[model samples]
Target: MTASTANAQRFREFKMPDVGEGLTEAEILKWYVKPGDTVTDGQVVCEVETAKAAVELPIPYDGVVHELNFGEGVTVDVGTVIISVDTDPGAGPAAAPAAQQAPQQAAAAETEDAEPQGRQAVLVGYGAAPSSTKRRARKPQAAVPAQPEPASAALQAELNGRAAPAPAAAPAVTPAAPAAAPVAPVANGTGAGSAGRPLAKPPVRKLARDLGIDLAAIAPTGPDGIITREDVHAAAAPAAAPSPAVPAEATGPVSAPAAAPEPGLVDVAARERRVPVKGVRKATAQAMVHSAFTAPHVTEFITVDVTRTMKLVQELKQDPDMAGLRVNPLLLVAKAFLVAIKRHPEVNASWDEARQEIVYKDYVNLGIAAATPRGLIVPNIKDAGVKTLPRLAAELGELVATAREGKTSPAAMSGGTVTITNVGVFGVDTGTPILNPGESAILAFGAVKLQPWVHKGKVKARQVTTLALSFDHRLIDGELGSKLLADIAAVLERPKRLITWG
Candidate 1:
């Protein structure tokens, strides 16, 4: 049926829009509403992560949330109807004559490529996603409002076909059942009125039910001498023996459930599995592959006597101002790179092949290449050149934590002007690092260890580390790369110089 036939009022349905350039789909990370949550136009309704980034999606209509089209973690094509606002449901489009004309006018006003009316348009670069053509499956209207049930109670019903009562839960007031009075002892086994068993709370009884043991059989051992999970387990152990034995024969004999099927003896292979490609893993893989191939990489390395840096690291960690901050060797190295990039600005520029020109970014978007189980993702700190030392250190910590947890989105990982990979975390001295795509340079920070070095023209013990710089040869020339790397080394050799240089 057409939207006009279904409702007299002109209501709008908001779908997932492609928010990034060259984007096709995004994962619905979360939904902030159910069927009936009242929402205003522009209020955040959901969060979606595309191959390029994660973004908060806002409601386009001010109305009650009539439906949520997809669950969290489901991938939706651009323009899919993810949410709908119930604007005067059943009133039909005729109810709002002016509103109907408005959409037609809006659609007519746009170019042929522009999105349809009543749908949110895809934003460019951190904007809304493109409109999807796929229609969402509508669910039947509920007889009553559905409230979220306790997880434990739901799990119990799934396993045993009976919902277990939660601890201290208020007695449910259903349409069929009258309000239950305070639970009275229902004597068991022996007699109705012979002081048959010790009285316990309703939850204690549920615990006994889940264990598949009689409540009267369990001996209470908690404060006020109530039964606990331990008590229930203890009482049920002997009864649990039968459950374990049934599985043994399924394995020992010609097994159907416990072991794999014999070559020719195939049973019904019943079940469908859908795997979702969303979140950090999807974002990371795309970013790494893009960076690896698109950016023409040229790596350069330098081994420096960083004894002074190590000493400074220790001194800073102990200082009252830096005590709470993470004063690591990598933090200092990242700071030094930020400072040096100012002098050799060419190293911080990107080669735009399509434009046939170098795009020089005045502000530094410093990315930290983080290795996560999903893949390698580089989430950067925006405008790092302007932040203080402590602020930079804190931002790095947050960036690393979010990337590792697979929570970093495409937006945070994109638009990086330069990148840093701390190879030192892997206990390696140094190796050439790849430049992140769309950026001109990547710096590798290597492990620091006591090594022999010449100090004041004599051989001596010194804290040493290696630094590697990989640049897009199409943009950054050898001269520019060397100057940037050397300047970083100079900062490490003389940590005190940054104060004077800045």
Candidate 2:
């Protein structure tokens, strides 16, 4: 083969793109296709969990899968090549002569191993991977010795530089002891380890190590008989048995009482549970800390009768225009907040620290705080200020469902100009919610309760609820904050204002 032909790039490398805004890395949760599988453009090849959310990446070009640069559960940095595809599958047999097939094949393998060079344009949000293709030459393999014993067969295969065989089928004969179960070979064809390491992700291995549980000892329940996190935790829990015999010194009167065990050492299996904070939880934490410390927050609270708002919610539920849609107190409260923002647009803005400017947003990207199994996330409705009541309700419902399913995209959660967090769902009365990062304000809606109150010189029952508005003091002074809160209360108190003022 000519040097130019060998230098031609036959394989297309798919780098790990920045799936989310400013995200540096993502963990490869799963791979849809293995090496040699056919893939088409726009096919979701893998699922990745970034700091913001779990996203599925689609391949942009059709090709045959040549290699997966990284294994599942590995956190790969943005711009790093994760997979490669053979764009010209037929070129191998057509270009290489029969006599030089072996040499051509070896050279092709080296080319595949080299790092990709030059920027290949990818999908939006992903710029391009770094450019520099270079690889080290591999040393030649040693010859295998003849007639090796069964016990030393694996060793001899490694010495001969043969790839390790796939893990053997589950043994019919069980080990005499549970902890003596044999380890499986590495799944990706790497040579077997001397100690027979088990097939498990790095995180799972770390978990087993931290919990002091042996992976081989635990019965595997995962796919391909791999050990899972649950298996490790279960093994760590001691089986029920009789208590150990106490020393005679404990029974003696002069003996000092046994000191309490350290918190970590006492009932480690049942009493302690450790969960690593990553992905959404980690991002939320960092943003909250930055917002709390950087923004001087001032929260103001006021209690108002929302009976009219609740009645209007029921009316809207029965309205023909609102049929088949979700109508609740939140719907009206959100409308009220939007209207209030319309009245006080200054509250809907962000402080630009670098520019040393108070940037006011004319458009409203209203964020609604949601609590999902993963963590707290705030996804917003874009251009909510112009959306009709029905449109706003629909967007709110979709946003909520997506957040609950832990599928809220980074784009949906970003660009929020103002936010509303309803704490009433958990039966909480009120809370001083911190401002979401970049946004100037967050309105906390508390639980609405029926209470007695003086109305027009007569005692009457009313639906009373408290609203807490938290804002950045640098942008919103007390007077402006108070006016925005009062405007929201007035709209909820008199539901007709939605049509009149809005």
Candidate 3:
């Protein structure tokens, strides 16, 4: 009670900010600071991954960290306090407030987030952000804990007093402790084990429950003995088990394609791994679905001879002026597309359903779709129409590098008017590209291959590639879309068009 209530003003709670375009949630990728660490104003406290991109969040003020409310890999609702700081640490010990106030704060937060007046729900695990203020009081949970373990569950995992049969590589309930069930609940707080309460975050606990893992039985391996996601996954993975332990619904899409492991040697289901979809992948899926269904998409394709463009690309690679830039077919194709947009500005417009109008953008935010370890993200270059070729190349390199590292900012990905997806990189010949949500058009550049062609009345091997343009038919008609695609092909066919048409 000391200073906890009396000096409550000393504790400053920092909530998760709306880090993306009205995104209601983000996952805690990592924490740079911890309780007792000093942090300054604008100091990065943690890195978070939203459905749009991964970004580092800086604390807005200075203080000594008092507590972190969540763990890594946990998706938290925006507006919920993620950390508490003792702004006036010298006044006295402020740690007691975290202990005394966590329950109250958690309750108040739940009520506030759940109130559906202005908030929008986002993502799956982020469902923690309730749609209603009062939670239903469910009582079966209490009664079930009082009952004995059923004989059917050979899943018992004992981390301390006894060891359960487990594959050598991963811990069973010894880490998840679910396999060690009958003995876990009374350990610390439901998550604690015989060794004291187990150290794990709420989302991790939820993962354990979904996988039928007992947290108390999990052996601690994370910093300060906290159980990590890998620990739970490992425990869930059986090396040579005859059958899968978790229910089919809980496991991720099993990757097993090989004929079912020879009967009895190894369980085919055991080879499966289920990774929860969240962050960028989940966002991209929802956006793609909405865009596909809402927009009346019309895709047009054109195969063009690019012998001159391919030759120019080689010359540019050897040019002393463009020595260090990323000189690739994509760079030239992007320039060609930009030139086309310059020739026809109306292609750079969006259909606003609410306003019942076609919004034309004065500036071009050119988006380049990049594939990263996390997922596909399209980060745009600002005011790209005005930049010189070299300057554009520099910005393009930075954007791609940033996206690949999974550090593209939400601001960089927003306000995009047009996009380009280079299917050529993956050796894809061509595809009916889909428009990025809110974008008017997307250009798909296919692989450039040497193919037989009639050149000046003679059969010869020439560089040829395909271009597919997808646009919103409601806003742009066939003629306008055809012109844009034609201009791109003309430029790529004759490199001089960048100067003439550009």
Candidate 4:
């Protein structure tokens, strides 16, 4: 039976449930199924990207997809219905196996008043029953019945060189509703039409808007005849689409775009781009500003002969214990820093203004500043003091890899008491490193190059590098900072100092 025919209560719409444990919000990365597509329970339905990771969400109901309540790239909080499903009548609560009834009982408790009670099949990850959370008073509104388009019909037409219908406007849903209401389906395209939908993922959709591209006009050439981003670029080449146009009145420029057909219809390319300052960069900026103003910074540099450290690195690389690791000078520098922090705990402390106390940590969480393609990110290793030299090197390698992939979680970037930025990797000698917001000290490691230096009162070629220490003078006085630098240098000058001093 058609969804419109079952208007009163025959069909069920399964909203997108909370997939991640205790997760409240997620960005719809991609929708794998459309209205009218058939899917079984456990079938991968959509991909959601939280602040944490990109996860593939599976279908909880074994039925035909009735509607997509949410669009891709939109951030919807937990319990928001992403799609609706029409379940088979025979698959009732009475028929579910006893072993599968556990989550249903929990679901009933959580979604007591909200979810339809006594439903049989539990969503794979979502609770077995509807939510029990009491909802606030809702405004008077009529529920939208489903449309008549057959499942996969419009999608199939798009793949067969026939133009798909223009997508209809989404329904006005109460943001507090369990699931979003699906937008009206567009009319099927006739004849050979050039119009098509964009092929990029949801995040890519946002990127295109920032870059200015219309999805409909872009032709499909990607897998499954989807319109790839490259297609959008080709279509947008002639007329550069600017940033998505915001309502002038809302932006305090109500007088702008007066001649346009409609505010939404305005050319995006003609609009200026504005980015919201949030996330890691915003946090970094605020912390840096606070540290720069509150803590008086003092920087000192020391040029050291590390001919022995370089030789040790080469020997460690060939050793069985350090096999398959990326052994380099930075690893030794990090180890040395840990040793120095032990001798001078003041460098691994923060000056708490409100508390009027200097907070010193007994353990070290080492932050490694890495410059990724996205931006500058410093994801740190937790409990670096506990790990062996080779183990620390491996952890450092993994940290760098995670940051590069933009997969660094907020937790990994937090609780760092000290930081080390290897400017040498970028072929630089040294830099006055900025102290990570809370911490009092940062160490910069320069490139190790063969230079003429005095070794044991004799002129000799040695592997030398420069170390720059930037400390918060309020916590670490010049004397303590200098001593810390000397300790680190002492370790690098002779690798045995780590065992002796540490």
Using lDDT, give the best candidate's number: 3
Clashes (N, CA, C under 3 Å) per candidate = 21, 0, 21, 14
**Local accuracy by lDDT, each model:** 0.68, 0.75, 0.77, 0.69
Candidates in order, TM-scores: namely 0.57, 0.67, 0.71, 0.56
Worst 10 residues of 3 by lDDT: 178-187
Off by over 4 Å in 2: 1-8, 90-265, 268-270
Residue 264, candidate 3: Cα error in Å is 8.5
Per-residue accuracy of model 2 over 280-360 as CA lDDT, tens digit each: 888889999999999999999999999988888888899999987888999989999999999999988889999999998
Candidate 3 lDDT (Cα, 0 to 1):
0.77
**Residue-level lDDT tens digits of model 3 in 334-373:** 8999999999999889988998999998899999999888
Error of 3 at 159 (Å): 16
Residue 444 CA error for candidate 3 (Å)?
A: 0.9
> lDDT by residue for model 1 over 1-502, one digit each (tens)?
7645655344567877878766888777778889878888889988787775457888878777766756675567787777767866545334333223433443343343333322321111212223335442243322332343455234333333344453454545455533332122222221111133433433345446654776554445653334555666676664343222222212223235567777988565434444344555676667667878877788999999888888888888888877577778888898899889877776678776787988877999999988776456788999999999889988888898887776676678778888899999889989977677688888999998888888999999888899999888888888888998999999999988778764
Candidate 2 or 1, higher TM-score? 2
Following a full C-alpha superposition, what root-mean-square deviation does model 4 have from the true structure?
14.7
State the lDDT of candidate 4 residue by residue for 138-183, as single tens digits: 5544555444253233433433444334345666665444444322
Task: Give candidate 4 misplaced runs (Cα > 4 Å).
Answer: 1-291
Worst 10 residues of 1 by lDDT: 120-129
